[model samples]
Target: MSASMDIRTKSLSKPVNVAQYLFTRLYQIGIRSVHGLPGDYNLVALDYLPECNLKWVGSVNELNASYAADGYARVKGISALITTFGVGELSAINGIAGAYSEMVPVVHIVGCPSTISQRNGMLLHHTLGNGDFNVFADMSASVSCAVAKLNDPAEVAAQIDHTLRECYIKSRPVYIMLPSDVVEDQVEGARLDTEIDLSIVENEPEREDYVVDLILKTLHSSKKAVVLADACAIRHRAVPELTAFLDKTNLPVFVTPMGKSAVDETKENYGGVYAGDASHPDVKALVEGADVVLAVGGLKSDFNTAGFSYKTSQLNTIDLHSDHCVVRYSEYPGVKMGGVLRKVTERLDMSKLSVQKIAHVGPQAVAEKLEGADQIIDQKWFWPRVSDFLKENDIVVTETGTANFGIWDTKFPKGVTGLNQVLWGSIGWAVGACQGAALGAKDAGSDRRTILFEGDGSFQLTAQEVSTMMRHDLNIILFVLCNDGYTIERFIHGEEAEYNDVVEWKYKELVTVFGGSEQRTKKYRVNNKGELDALLNDQDFNDRKGMRFVEVVMDRMDAPNSLRLTAEASAKNNARRE
Candidate 1:
């Protein structure tokens, strides 16, 4: 080995294309798959990506791919999706909007026509006959920070780096447009060292001291105070911090539906998921009767608040939201939720507050209810048995509609939880999320099994994803909640007689239909609790011999009670408002 001619020197001597280098940088920043439907303009990126160790996921439509990427990013930290100039990009707006609404970090990479062609007024494939790129650029402003580019090879590295950092810091989506001419050009400039920049800019919640001081003062005055935690709290990963705050204060805790996983459900003092009837009578009484109501990371939607019951003039309400914003309804002023909670938690009197006492009772009450339901819970029955088999570490994702309602009462062992209550209420989210969760678990090098409780209606929407899962042979468990109808919509307001019903398919046969080998799928049908019990007790079901699909037959007549009530209340409320 020559002393002067080292590995670094030799590696530096070799030249690489700028586009190729930029794609590599994306891989370094955790862009797994370039999700999109192939198009003429974007074909360059599709060609260049495989060399960078990226796989192009072929979606039936650009929108589905974007949504898949969004779900993947939401669970797996980060992901990117690509599409063609105008048509592909336009098609993906719905998924982008959903990501924007939920504050998910997804990068939208769009390929555009060359600058000369764009300026020459040439008709583009997906364009509305106008060469005006302003329309394309303007569409992204509401949901993302979008930048369209001319062929500047030098700015590739800088723009990529800037866009990622901006999106990460803001916890929002960002868009970057690549012109076809630019992507094919080779850079003649000196190469910069390719390293992963994972640093995130932390914005401390504004007005800290005032928020905490007000909360402490309010706590001292109120005899019965409650903390209403919502999805924002989970977004900030403030569960443990909020849990610590709850314990120190010994205040009652009630989570909105979106915040169901906010605290360990197995913990005592946790009023199991509250909103209308899901709010236990005791939890409801405390919430409705409280003098000072601290709503943390709350959603102001009618669904979360039970038709804005808390929109009161008399009660002193402190609202801390996920957006790092705060508001109050009080004779006295209050502070932002994050600032106050952070400050109060930092320096607090912990000597007197014994909140662990509530921990014992909180989970106990939930467990009691679960057990009571267990009397009617038959192992031969798919939902109850599957619910029972779920351990503390296993993660579960449920679809919207009937399956969502069915699993409302399913118990997660103290720490076991998953994502299902994303605000957009998008169906087919659970199946995609299950894939992401399984990937996350495998990446963590843990044996924590990832499972999905999918509704029959929603399962059909993303059925193609099964091919992706089977192709990868992911350690995932899929339990299809087979009710033979769109029971959720039927319960909500749809006509069960015609449109709500679906033609029954042998769901297990889908594995083979989707190209999974016989070894890749194990099929089971459970009509009653006995069949469910056998499957639940069988250890073979957990083995990764293949993807497991357990079809649990549910009575359409006995639809989920919570879902039925939710729809009814929402309808009645809308009627009243009208």
Candidate 2:
């Protein structure tokens, strides 16, 4: 036998190409689809996707692909995106940074030149004429929890597994550099037998028990206690524990803006959205007046906390976090929130807890307060009605403009998942994220509907993503709120500035222009409440199996109340102080 054949016969398992090994790892981790656009460097590797039964989602651009990947990861636990070296990876950086800031787990893979070319210092097309291949990898490391430059065949499998494990456990994006030549390099397939360790980091048992005891003692003595859940609760995958605590205590539960839909809003003990001064009057009174506050996975970003407007005292707050626990003045490091929450719930004494009485003050009660039912669609009436239109388990993706703030007054049905980039506040994220989230919902094997509400200005940034959704035949409903320009920007600095204005496109005609057939794509234009109501009430429109687009016209100056308040505070903070 030949030397190679003789060695192959004695191998513990058959050899697999680098692409096969990578795809198999992804598949084993529940990734049914791979998201990215094809570039020359990655084209050969793309051929190996179907070998492992992974569908390729070819997004319109690298930036949109990254955004879509973020959305997919938020829904499906983890997702992967691929791009060519410099140009492609740089375009996706903004989205990756957003994922890092918001703690979404996405795998960003960049395909680069062969080892020979890189070693020879060959100037690549995507390069900055510097003959440097390591620059992009270095830049990505800042935004990723871990990065793997897959160059050695001997260690490729281990590198991929370790990087993926970081992405999973940290719940943040990871970067992988896959060389074009490495795409076909042979690796030991036997390494796939050991699954990546994705278990949550454990806390020191003695410290954990002490923290739980302190929390219990504080809660038992408090005359009033409130639970405030935020984005990290969901990002760290601790919703079960958070919900259990809420259900057991029956304490008034509230959410920060970034933590929308973290808890079951349909529950009786639920209060309403709390974003400091931007909060509802009733919600503000309830949350600020608490004696002891239990904050779970709290992320107090500027806008999320209404420009640092929180009145809650840390002296009376017990902040539960992913890596540490804070009780009033004491801090317990390495004590992750998951274990602490689980322990707290397990040891919770129901009788010692001061249960809060329920009073209705959430999104559902806003309709009766809305006085006018004018034909013109106003922001006040539009959002509350959207709350009613939403169904359970629907994936709702909102833009960072008015849609993000407008959704504050909108209470979600049970099991609804909200996708938005509030901290990074990137524009044009929703369209791409909607495509990814819809695919994620489909991958989850649920009958969930994916819906998007984006300002015309924001949607125009990445409208091509909708075409990708059409290509996949995914069910999605896109609602474009046409109000002339960037509504959020208008409230911040430029109400009448020309910079915020955008060239309005015929939005309803986009589906057809994107090659949507009449049978698969539908469009509607509603300028008034009556027109919107008729379409919303139609059973046929509601049960459609394909893409649906609605252009709802509104006033240019009108903004959501939350947006106005947040913008006002932001504008004041921006100017030079006396």
Candidate 3:
């Protein structure tokens, strides 16, 4: 026999069910739970999750399940969601799109019809009336980095490994379609013994060194330099390396809105959250005024940059991205960010760099204090107060509309992880995300508090997921900002339009309606500052386990200052003729 044939023969081992192989692969990659809703096509596949030692988190709907999976992936590095073909997969497409936009890795597994049905061109119930089996996979191809339809047992294991590797290396969602007949097919079990290779391509040594030298030369030449960290830093898991670089240089570091909590805010050199015009005055000046700005893992989306209000010039910036790096107008491709950052830090000569003498005002010091015994819970009062309420290692999930924008001003303690879909701007994302995030936290053995700040209008979109959270008995604190209508829309155009108004449900009663027992659940409705303060100050409420819901009442027109500014900018951008 040839050497290659001998190796192949030796590598082949005992055959195992395809479903077992798939779930075992997911388990090997640290996915403790699979999130999805059961459907006829996928029900049989779901049975193997337990045998593989993976928990099944059944969501109320496919959309919520996808959102939860996205959240779980953000915390756990990667997560999986199983949905039926066509209808179920299409419903969850939006959430998957968000994952793609934000660089979150999620494996979207669609349980397809039997291979016989597809080959014979039989009309499947979930599919379009026509005999097309490839429509949903085509749609998923737009958002996902990899797409694989597993039918042949001989190739299923290799396909699964390839798809998952793409998902990890790209840090984006991947699609897999498993036909019912193929679920139990026999595949080599030894494939699981070989770890999936998820390693990224190494940086070109010469190109990386040239770019690092340019950055160092620029930094030494400039009198003022600043470090700006963004969401991609967190998505790529470059925080530890980025933090070490920041500590080494002691450069004034500021986080973008979507990148909040990327850096240790407690560090002395930490400036503040910078959101272009929405930034605190000092923060805006420090970043915009710098001669050389080093932006690491930067994602300059509209909402993140406050509708493109940033004043920094590209000529003076060094942008370090996941796959490449750009210095001023020059671009260096195939240079990995993590390696470049580590090399730069190791080679940086701190003595040559000038010390910047800028006044660094912490979030608490810059936050506006409540004025004159105002009873209403306004943005100015609420955000700062919540800053004090935040504990270490809490996972804070913010909804798109108000909570997403408002969270920019709130200070996070050390070890805190902030989850927000700023680029997608999907309104109902956080409720489902909170459920998945809580489960991910539990699986990781991190006893961190899972807190969600959701808007009334946004929460109504995916409120059923709260029931899923209750069903699992996951401990979470949900703060429903009960402003009568869509305050964000009002800030953009109509201040009091009927179209923006959402149906008012007794928010506090939702816990009971969602099947949470009163004995295990704690619910509160606070209409004034005094009432809200009492609940926040209560030790029992603060330290209690299980679900706790708080409905905070605010005026319909009330909004955070940052949202107000961004909304106005958005309106102006929409109206521009040129």
lDDT of each: 0.65, 0.89, 0.89
TM-score of each: 0.84, 0.97, 0.96
Clashes of each: 18, 0, 0
Local error of candidate 3 at residue 163 (angstroms)? 0.6
Per-residue alpha-carbon lDDT of candidate 1 for residues 1-578, written as tens digits (9 for 90 to 100): 33442443345444456557667766777665666778888787678887888766665567667776775675666667788877888888877877777777778888888767887988867787877865776888788954535356545657777777666645568888878777755543244464645553333445555556666666666665667788777665567668878766766777776676677666556665566554445556666666767777777565555445443323467776544434354322333344457677776655533332233212222222233332333222334445567877777777776555545456567667556644666777666656656654554465667788887877877777776667667677888877767775675566557887877888878888888777767778776555666677788886565488788777665665556666677677756743
Ranking by lDDT: 2, 3, 1
By TM-score, rank the candidates, best first.
2, 3, 1
lDDT of 2 by residue, 307-386 (tens): 88999998889999898889999999899999888888889899898887858585663343434444678888888888
TM-score for candidate 3, please give it. 0.96
Query: On a 0 to 1 TM-score scale, where does candidate 2 land against the true structure?
Result: 0.97
Location of the lowest summed lDDT over 10 successive residues in candidate 2: 365-374
Off by over 4 Å in 2: 1-12, 365-374
